[model samples]
Target: MQNFSKALLSWFDVHGRHDLPWQQDKTPYRVWVSEIMLQQTQVQTVIPYYERFMTSFPTLQALAEADQESVLAHWAGLGYYARGRNLHKAAQTILQQHQGEFPSDFEAIVALPGIGRSTAGAILSIALQQRYPILDGNVKRVLSRYFAVEGWPGEKTVEAQLWSQAQMLTPLARFDDYTQAIMDLGATLCTRSKPRCDACPVAHGCAALAQGRVAEFPFSKPKKTLPVRRASFLMMLNQQRQLWLTRRPSPGIWGGLWSLPQFESREDLIAALNPSMQTTEDSPASLVKWEEFRHTFSHYHLQIEPHRLDRVQEAPAEWQGQWHDLDKAAQLGLPAPVKKLVEQLEKEDGQNG
Candidate 1:
């Protein structure tokens, strides 16, 4: 354990990110925020968002009291909106149940919304300097390669073995540095593709390296094909330059966020748009523009056909439609794809005008 710690620390001093904003004071709250944001998100992509999030909700109390819409607005561009929702909920719980303090107990932390065993462990080890094992993707790859672990790490049996190994190597002293070091190594050196084995400090000690199986140790699981789903987005506009928008339901994809009205098919959408008057009304419905875009989710793909209606009589009951100036509408906290669609419309309008 001592030797392993020494090797990792020595490597981290030269290669690890020592100046990350979250590492400045190393508080439990700061570490917790960064850890949660970095889940399945890249470092470069998370930096700006993390800074803005911290600035807005600097403390648990601020986040707890913040409106759900405001929180989602801050997190608009960042996909996986559920993370932000869970974060807000967890903040409220901490404030109400724990008196505005982050729970130090592992079980208590895990009980919070969106927190899991690995995330709880990370908050404890990095923020509190406690010796807790983290089983995040990078750490899993590092440990699996170091010990030549077999089977898919996602499997419970394989993950249990890795957890035990992680516990064994976690040094009581310098636990924080050790935790950061291993993660850095995996992220930078022992990457999923094209690992920098020549410069790795523990390359000689890696069982997978000795066996010429650096990539094989962290076994890969078969990829599942994402199912394709289709939907229509009603881009309702008036002469006032304001666009109609609606709030999505509180759960499922794009949960609790504002977006254009979505329907299962174009025919259903047309029916909703023209409920009373038949398609052959005296004044035909004016469609100023129309376009289509695709947004991909983890488990599925969404084919969105945007139908732009220049004029409309009334909006459907499911939609809380209101018109805001295009610029103001941008500030209404629409999801990234919806925002992109609006930007495209703005560009087209500019070109036409």
Candidate 2:
């Protein structure tokens, strides 16, 4: 096991991503932030965002003290807004309860708002140099193929068996390098699609490689079809160059984020808009632009149609719509699709004027 660990680490020292910003200083805070950001996100995609986020919220106190809007603003382009919210909440917990320091104990780390066992293990092993086994997708693939574990890893019994194997193989000395090496090996060699067994450092010992089943050991369950949902967004603009936006409820998709008014259907939108449009008797409101866009979530797809109203008598529903300069709205924390809609509307308005 020590020789295997040494060989893996030797390979990692030369080939692994040693220059990543997060790897520069493997503090608990930095590792925690990077791990949380890396959830369901690729490392390449997270690099620039991670650097910018660390700059903005350099310390746990900074993150905990940050307003939800500011935190969401930094995390705007990053999907999974819930992670940002959880990060902020967890920071607050650490500040209030743990004196603004990340917990060193594995169990305490897992007890944080969004840190699970795998994430906790990652932090413990990488930052604290503790021997904790992680069962992330990459590790699962590498271990399952090396040991030829059977059944879909998502199943409880199968996952338990693989985890037991993982614990047995985790070395005590140089645990951090070994942990990262296996993850890197799985990500770069034992990939989900076409595993590069020839390039694997531990290929000689891989049972799946010998059996020509490298891609079959880490079995997956069948995927379900994502349901499609429909919604309507009203892009209301006033003469002051400000757009009307609303804060989403604190739960569900895009929760606690500011966005355009969304309705479940065209009828609901019409019913909601009619009374408000009727109250303002200066001029009749007409739809200046209509466009449809789609945003895909993990379990569903949202098909949204945007109805832009150029002129309106008064703002509806106590929205207190502010008149922001076009450039300022770009900096505000609007969702990516909403930002695109706003840009399109601004371009159209510029052309008309």
Candidate 3:
């Protein structure tokens, strides 16, 4: 175990990532946000978002004080929107509970919204140089093959084994770099597919490789069919070309973010809207149709039917949501599908004008 850490650290000295945006001036806030963003997202994808996010909210206090809309606006287009909302909630929690400090204690930090055990460990290790074992997806792949651990990492038994192994191999000294090293090794060499076994420093000790079963160690989650759902995104625009947007209710899909009004079906949306809201007396009676598309989630696919009201009459309060100038709507934190819908509408407006 000790030698394992030594070899990994040595390799990290020459090849580990050294220039990530958050890595420049390591702070718990930055590391915490980066860790959350990096979950299920590639490093390249996270870099720009991270830089833009830091520019907007540079400190824990800034994040804490930001309105949820503003916070989600900065995080728009980065999927797993809950991360942004949770980040904002956690910041405020830190202010109220930890006295505006990013909590260093493991349990305290993990208790924060969206911060799990591995995330807490990674933040404390990387930012505070605290000795804690982290078993993120990258580390899971590395450790699974190195020891040929058999069950799916999501299973409690397999997860416990991986945690124990991570803890054992984690050296007490320079644990920060050790944390980064293992993650780097997994990301760069012991990758999910087409691993660079030749570049792996720990290849000599990898049990799966020794058994010629490298691909079989990190057992994948048992496959289940993703359910498909359907919805209609109503793009209600008035004469002023202001598109109506709704703030999704908290704790729901795209929660706490603005989005086009969603209905179960096109018929349902039309039925709910006031007949007068369809079009103005002076305008044509017809509505405009836009592109229909699908947005896939991890467990479900939403088949969206987009519709636009060319000149909606004054909407009653029951219509809900507010209309925004086309340009201003772009700045709101919208679901990807809604954003795409908006962009499509904006493009048509530009061409028509």
Q: Which structure among the candidates has the greatest TM-score?
A: 3
> Alpha carbon lDDT of residue 96, candidate 1?
93
In terms of lDDT, which candidate is stronger, 1 or 2? 1
Cα lDDT tens digits, model 3, 112-171, are 888999999999999999999999999999999999999889888999999999999989
1-353 per-residue lDDT for model 1 (tens digits): 66777888888988888898888998878898898888989888899999999999998898899999999998888888878878988898899999999999999999988899889988898889888989899999998999999888987899999999889888877778888888888889989999998999987788999999887869876476466788998787655667778878778678877899888767557657756422235456765436677899877889888888764545555557566676677777788889987887777777877
Shift of residue 238 alpha carbon in model 3, Å: 42
Candidate 1 backbone collisions, by pair? none
- Model 1 poorest ten-residue lDDT run: 274-283
Local error of candidate 2 at residue 201 (angstroms): 0.4
- List residue ranges in candidate 3 displaced over 4 A: 224-353
* Ordering by TM-score: 3, 1, 2
Which residue pairs in model 2 clash with each other? none
List the candidates' TM-scores in order.
0.64, 0.64, 0.65
Per-model lDDT? 0.83, 0.81, 0.87
Candidate 3: which pairs clash?
A: none
Weakest 10 consecutive residues of candidate 2 by summed lDDT: 274-283
